[model samples]
Target: MGGLIFIFVQVLVAVFLCINFMLITTFFTKEFFYTTMRYILFAVTLLSDCVILIVTNLLIICNYLKITMNLWLCAIMFILSTVYSSVTPFTLTAMTLERYVAICMPLRHGDLCSTRCSLHCILLIHGLSSIHFIVDLSIYFASTSIKFYKQSMICNVWIFILYRWQDHLRNAIKTLYFLFMCITIVFSYVRIMKAARAASGEDRKSTWKGLKTVILHAFQLLLCLIQLWCPLIESAVLQTNVKAYINLRYVNYIIFYVASRCLSPLIYGLRDEKFFCAMKSYLLCGFYKKKNVI
Candidate 1:
């Protein structure tokens, strides 16, 4: 029964990821590149999600087949999961910062949000997100034995997650990384919203629009962050209570995968009419007339 359900969820997740891929592909088309930096970061998030989704589906299929994954593959799965988890908040912070400048510091928004600046922001974020993971990964594999992991055929990132707590280096890195990313995201949004609230006469209309967009983006990020932490939460729960059902771990994975991949694009990406129109155009394969972006 568990295997059947896993298979079912895998099918659904794969389908949703395909839709996400299509939508993100549309984002790179000529029309969508007008706002280059914003779209680039958007594409990065979508691509990062694709990485996680593909790996997740592969892992699920392997489990259903009872094929054991070697330590390397398992490590790759865990690393990719951490990578996606980190990139999420980093990208979100950058986006919020972008919006903050657009609303709160409109005079300098052009320079701050330029293509070059956005690219620099992306590089910096990727660096910050990966440095601690690199250290954690090194320390983890150095001292820990993976013989059991290779034999278990679990094929899930959560496996590595549960063990990391035992290694002080990994434990510290994980704790600090999550805390810092969460702080940055929350702080950026708070600042952005505060700026929106203080807008006056000439900028009121624009401020209101920016505020709405930021709220929608914040909602999406909040959901993603919650999903990212579910595994950790599950691990903590299992540690404290022997009575906790083991199945809830998979429950968290499926819910997180679906919510982050499927709902995010639908909820936040749709706000941009041009992008939505582009998505429709891509899906219809040119048969539909492109709407004018007046």
Candidate 2:
């Protein structure tokens, strides 16, 4: 059963990674996508999601194989996973804000969301995401002896928990981080919705589209936030029934983690008519060229 679950996870990860990779390649190949703030942000989200999927699944594979490594190595993997996992929501919030500006404050959108500004936002998102990891590392180093770092341990985030208070602190910080992101997205959605109602014709259609994108962002954020609770949920199930806990664990990982990451590609890569056309062209290179020639 464990092997079956591992295979299932690997397949899901491969499928999403391939889709995201193609979208990212499309973004880079098209010069116009690089200049557009929305597409730039979407690309960043895709890249971040890819990293998260890879790192998390690598850890899962290690666990399934009962692989143990030095404490420091495990910490590095765990921290990478945590940091990138945080990046998706931050990127999503930025994407929502971009949509908000585009729809609600159209005249100022160009000035506010320039290519340079988008790049800076991407940098800021990563820097901000690393803050939690930095804090956790600090606490970990302060709590543990140097010798402890040399010992072998299973590569799990829980291994970093030197004390009960540390876990509580991590949860508290996560709550605050997600709360801020949720508020930003909600504010964006509400403002965009109002703009949609106030506009007409093409502008109204655009505003409505932006509103729907924000809604998708909100849903993605909800999924990311729910992942933080999965361990607790699993623990509860474990106390009741081990078999049920095992099944619930796989379900939560797939639904919250894997499925959430899938949303970025669906929302931008496939749903956006312009991006979809470009992506399709790249994905069907020979066929597209032949059709175009004919």
Candidate 3:
């Protein structure tokens, strides 16, 4: 029964990711949303996360179905997943910084946060985050002692990073990295709030919108940290044997993977008024077309 439920939720999450990907793609393809570099950053992050969601859900579903998920290709997908997920936080931080500059340094924002610069920023972050992926790959090859704990179904690659690798160092590094990002995120928002607070009475209304957006971005970051970076879920396989609450492992997978995927676009991406309006029109038109067909 637990297995059945896991598979069901896994399928639902996959469907959710597909729908979001389609909507996001439609949002980007429309010419109107090309107003700023932030949209491009959101698009890249949304698409990458959509890919991560699909891959992670597939792994869980395959494992639940008693299928062999371990393959050379699986390892590659795992690294890709790690890379994209790792890069997502930095992309989000970059977005926040872009917004900060736009609000607090409006005059300079035009020259600074252009689309090309944002793309380059994202690429640089991706390149840097891949250091973890590269290290994981090298250690994976070098250490014959490392092995996947296959006691249960739904093998997540994070399980390998925790159990197989020099897990202590990795976990500490991961914890610190996430911490540093969170601090940077908070500090950026703090400045935004300060700017909002210190605004001239005449500019208060405009400043408030910036404050609201920054708060929303911070909220979304908190959600990401809580949902995806929880030590309980990440280190759970290492701390406890897989046989114990093995079924709960699937629940954790659903909680972390599905929730993270759902939150990113819905919370972060949709917060853009323009993007949301475009999506609303796109979705409503599609619904009407299907209704007319029916």
Candidate 4:
């Protein structure tokens, strides 16, 4: 059963990775996507998600295979996973704000969401995401003995968290971060809703679409935030029933970690008519051309 579960996860991860790579390829190969702020942000989200999926899956595979890694090497991989896990929410917030600007303040959207501005936003997201990693690293160095860094261990975040206070600190930070993002997304949604009410004709249609997009972002953010509780939930389950805990852990991992990542590509890539058409063309290659010729 465990072997079958492992295979199922690997297959799921492989499918998502392939889809993400296809979307990424379509975005980069086309010059049109580069000039637009939303597509650029979407591409960044896809790229970050791909990295997260790859790193987390690799860690899972290592654990299943009973392969041990040096502590320092594990820390490096964890840092990458942690950082990109953060990047998704920040980028989602930025994307939400972009939609708000486009809908509520249409006149200024072009100036506010220029390619240069979008790139700056990407940098800012990375900068903000790295803060948690930096602080965690500092605490690790100050609190942990250097000898542990040379030891071999299974690569897991808990291995780096040596102290109970570190867990409390992490929980506090996660809660605060989630609140900030939740507020931002809520504010965007409210403003877009108002714009939709005031708009008419094509304008109203666009505003409603933007409003729905913000709602989807909020849903995605909630999914991402739910991941923070999985460890605790799993721990509780483990104390009650080992067999149940095993099943629950796998289910939680797929739903929160793997499925949450799928939301971004689905929300932006598949839903956007322009991007979908381009993506379909790229994915189908000459099929569209042949059909057109017919």
* lDDT on C-alpha atoms for all candidate structures: 0.68, 0.87, 0.69, 0.89
Q: What does candidate 2's lDDT look like per residue over 1-294, in tens digits?
A: 856887998999999999888888899878999999989888888888888888888888877788988887888787888888888899899989988888878799989999999989988988988887788788889987899888997888877777888777888888998999999988998888888898999989888888888899999999989987988888899999988886787788899999999999889987899999998787799677889999
Q: Model 1: residues >4 Å from true position, as ranges?
A: 31-35, 144-175, 194-203, 227-229, 232-246, 288-294
TM-score of 1: 0.78
lDDT of 3 by residue, 149-235 (tens): 223334557544635336666566666767877787787778877788888785766677766766666665666566444556645
- Candidate topping TM-score: 4
Task: Sort by lDDT, best first.
Answer: 4, 2, 3, 1
Query: TM-scores of the models, in the given order?
Result: 0.78, 0.94, 0.81, 0.94
Better by TM-score, candidate 4 or 1: 4
Model 1, span 206-228: residue lDDT tens = 66666666666666566665664
Question: What CA root-mean-square deviation does each model show from the true structure?
Answer: 4.8, 2.4, 4.1, 2.5
Question: Which residue segments of model 2 deviate by more than 4 Å?
Answer: 286-294
* Residue pairs with backbone atoms closer than 3 Å in model 1 (clashes): none
Error of 1 at 177 (Å): 3.9
Order of the predicted models by TM-score, top scorer first: 4, 2, 3, 1
Please report, as a residue range, the 10-residue window in candidate 4 with the lowest summed lDDT.
Answer: 280-289
Query: How many clashing pairs in candidate 4?
Result: 0
lDDT, candidate 3, equals 0.69
Higher-scoring candidate on TM-score, 1 or 3: 3
